[model samples]
Target chain A: MLNLIANENMKIYRRMRTWILVILIVAIVLLTGILMKTHEAPPSSNWRTALQAQTTQLQQELTQVQGKHVFMPARATAGMEIQIKKNQYEISHNIAPAQYTAWSFTSTIEQRAIGVLLTVFVAIVAGDIVAGEFSSGTIKLLLTRPQTRARILLSKYVATLIFAVFMMAVTIVASLVIGGVLYGFANASQTYVYMDASGHVQQMGMIPYIFTNYAFNSVSMLMTVTIAFMISTIFRSSAIAIAISILSLFIGNTLVAVLSSYSWDKYILFANTDLSQYVFNGPLISGMTMTFSIIVLVVYFIVMNGLSWFLFKKRDVALT
Target chain B: MADQIAVQIRNLTKRVGNKTIVDGLSFDIPKGEVFGFLGPNGAGKTTTIRMMVGLISISEGQVLVQGIDVEKNFSQAMQHVGCIVENPELYKFLSGYQNLKHMARMSPGTMDARIDEVVKLVGLQNRIHDKVKTYSLGMRQRLGLAQALLHQPSVLILDEPTNGLDPAGIRELRDNLRRLAREEGMAVIVSSHLLSEMELMCDRIAVIAQGKLVSVQTLSDLMSGGERHVITSFEVGDKALALSILNRLFKDHVVDDDNHPHLISLKIDKERIPDAIQALVEGGVRVYGVSAVTKTLEETFLEMTGDGIIA
Candidate 1:
């Protein structure tokens, strides 16, 4: 099994396409950093004064909305309150109003670059892992090995997952190096501030924050890979698999938002894909918990993989 | 013992929707012999080979490789078998050596030494490091053969093994398959629609048409065992006299042919050719030429299958 996976890895990494993906990630990271650096809102030396002024304005707004009959949304009020609290906390702790650093830049890339571009790149890899073999007519050579069809499928799946992790690591390292070189490498132990699920502002280290974001984001990434893989197995065309997967990945959130009024929307895969909602903000739909979303994601994962295994094993390889 | 049999295909059948692709194919390939599966286009030759290698599912019956049932225990059965289904599709993005190494990893116990041995066996040592996309069809075929022989399987099966080879390449493949079967005691099964190639490569040939087995015979038996009739053509003088003389002496043996004026065609056994010639000479008919017509396998295949379905 290990050797099979190694074979898959060799096939993956030896191709110029895979290297091109890596280069794209690095280039995108550098371009984004260069763009950000050139945009120059020079670092404010009076950050404390700015924080105090922001806090005062937020307080005035809170007081005005407290007794007024003006129709303000409750969620908007809560968001303002959280922002004021985070500002006050930063001021009291003298955290200097989120200064630019290598750690922070890496964190930003994790949010912006890894969120969309990484998913698309990983989707391309996962999508092509199985269907590409069929398209090239090498599936005959692959399936006729002594290993069973199930084992071969498993190996490909595992190899795609390894590639996803490897790409994630590459993006992380690239973003950090570019970020550190452009912005200073100082503040390696910076603190990040955010609101918890209990409506209180909290602080965490920069490294942990990035990793926690990745951990939470990986739930959605996992689903994307599996969905692409399932489509890859079902169809013999890599373009179809990749296009549908990317389309769904971008459309999933919009789909959830469009249907958020429906009570059953909580059961949708996109709604549960963002497990961080349960950890920090809350579920997309009210009354959905972390356990429920985990269960939903697990079921989707199992069903997708089950269908892949069934189709891969039972369907005849009649490619002419 | 049952170990002498390399592959036992018993009542193997394949059905797609309402149509049968390969029906009730049963044959045992013994060790140290080259077996041929010959058929016309759309004759289920590829489908049958696919089923034997577990590429396609067997609808009704089973295939056993070295006495192990394929459908029951596919991996174990496949361990004893190595096959190339159709045109040897390799990883074109990878070098030929990398392709072989990739395949060698799948079949456990295939060492680097074994890979090198098979590379040398297929005579691909010089170009083995080049990418397959740069290879000609014949080179790819050799690499495909090398991949199949890497693990030293007891049974080696190739479908349309001579599809894209030049004459020399085809001859080399034939010699390699023959030597592998003879020296290593491996059972080599090759399928082709090219009858003459099969004639030179296979020890026994199984002919099928439209999913039905037509005949299975040894090469010699298929060529000369059953029929002794040779159509003898005689170029003679005095067409009327020669025809009359031939008809009088060999009444039922003479063919009513009018393609030539002085030529007489007779379907006669070999032993009676001298008597007919002497009788014609004594009857004052000059015999200029006497030649026996031979039937090629193409003619025999068309006769057996009875149509224009050959590729």
Candidate 2:
């Protein structure tokens, strides 16, 4: 089984396309860093006075909106109140609004790159791993071996997952290096502030925040990769598999939002993909808990992989 | 004797939609023999080969490789088998050596030394390190064969192995396949529409047409028309007189030879050649030469398949 996985990895890494994806990630990170550097706001040394002035201005806005009849006035006032409390917390704790440091840049890159680019890249690789063999007519060579079909499919699945992890690592390492070089690397111990699920201000170290973000994003990445793999195994055309996976990736969140009014919408895949919402913000739909989403995700994971294994192990491979 | 049978296919059938592609075909390929599958296009030769190697699903019946059921115990059955479905479509982006290595890893117990040996066996040592996209069709064919032979399987099955090879490449493949069967005692099953190539390479040939088995005979028996009469042509100086004499002796046995005035042909038994020659000589017809023209595999195949298109 290990030998088969090595073969799968060889097939993936030996191609120039796989390496191009890594290089593309690094290049995009560098470009993003350069752009962020040029547009960065200058650091304020008098941040304490600035925080007090912002609190006073927010208080004025809060009073003006208090008696007004507007759409979502309560929600607007709640957001303003959270901002005032955060400013007060920073002033009392002597934690200035974060400056543009290497850790901050890494955090920023993680937010943008992991959500959009990394998922799409991993989806492309997973989508092609099985379908590529069929389209190229190499499936015959691959299947006419001593290994069972189940083992072969499992090897491919494991290899694709390893590839996703490797790509995420590359994204992280590249962003850190670029962010460190462009911005100063002095704020490794900085704290990130956010409103927790209970609407209370919470603070954590910068490094732990980045890791938490990755851990949350990885859940979605796992689902996306499995979807791509299932599609790849079921369909013989790599183009169709890749296009469908990417299409679903871009539209999953939108689909959840469009259907969020229905009670059953919470059971959808996208609703459960972003587990971080349970930790930082509230869930998309009311009554959704961390346990519920995890259950939904596990069910989806099993069904998708089960269908893949059933179809792959039984379907006849015709001449392509 | 039963132990010598490398592959036993019984009632092997394939049906797609409402049509049957292969209908209850049964055959046994023993060890140390080069077996040929002869059929026209869409005649189920490729389908049968695919079923034998467990590439396509078997609709009915079963394929047994060295006593292992192919569909039931696929991995064990496949361990004794190596096959190329059609064109040896390999990874064009990978070097020939890398492609071989990829296959060797899937098939356990195949060492690096075995890979090198198969490379040298296929005469691809010089270009083995080059990417397959740079190889010609013939070289890719050899690499495909090397990949199949890497495991040293006792049963080697190839579907149209000579699809895109030059004359020299075809001869080289034929010689190598024959040598593998002879020296290593492997059962090499080859399928092709080229009757001449099959005649030269196969020890026994199984002919099929329109999903039905037409005939299965040894190469010599198939060529000689098995117990049937042969077309014997006699070159004579006096064609009209020779025809008249041959007609008077055996009217139904004489064949028309008007196309060539110097030739008189007969479809006759081998034992009566002396009687015809004596009658021709006594009737003042000078016979220059006499020759028995045995039927080639082409004629025999055409007769069996009712002149189906070879392609």
Return the TM-score for candidate 2, rounded to 2 decimals: 0.93
lDDT of 1 by residue, A1-320 (tens): 99999999999999999999999999989999998888857758898898889889988887888879456766677788778877876676555654567898999998876667888998998899899999888899888887888999999989988988898899889988998899778767667766666555567888998899888877788899899888988887799999999999889999999998888888889888988876676566778888898999999999999999999999999846
CAPRI level of candidate 1:
high
Query: How well does candidate 1 match the true structure in TM-score terms?
Result: 0.94
DockQ of each: 0.82, 0.81
Where model 2 places Cα greater than 4 Å from the true spot, the runs are: A41-48, A59-78, A81-98, B309-311
TM-score of chain B of each: 0.94, 0.96
Per-residue accuracy of model 2 over B1-311 as CA lDDT, tens digit each: 99999999899999999889899999999999999999878788988998888888999999999999998898888889988888887999899999999999988788999999999999999999999999999899999999999999999999999987999999999999999999999999999999989989999999999888988899888887775677899999888778778888888988877788798789988888999999988898888999998887788888888767633
**Candidate 2, DockQ to 2 decimals?**
0.81
lDDT of 1 at A308: 90
Question: How far off is residue B81 in model 2, in Å?
Answer: 1.3
lDDT of 2 by residue, A128-236 (tens): 9899988888889878898888998899989988998898789888888998898777757777767777665577888999889988988998998888878888877
* Isolated chain A TM-score, each model: 0.90, 0.89
Q: Relative to the unseen true structure, what is the C-alpha lDDT of residue B44 in candidate 2, on a scale of 0 to 100? A: 84
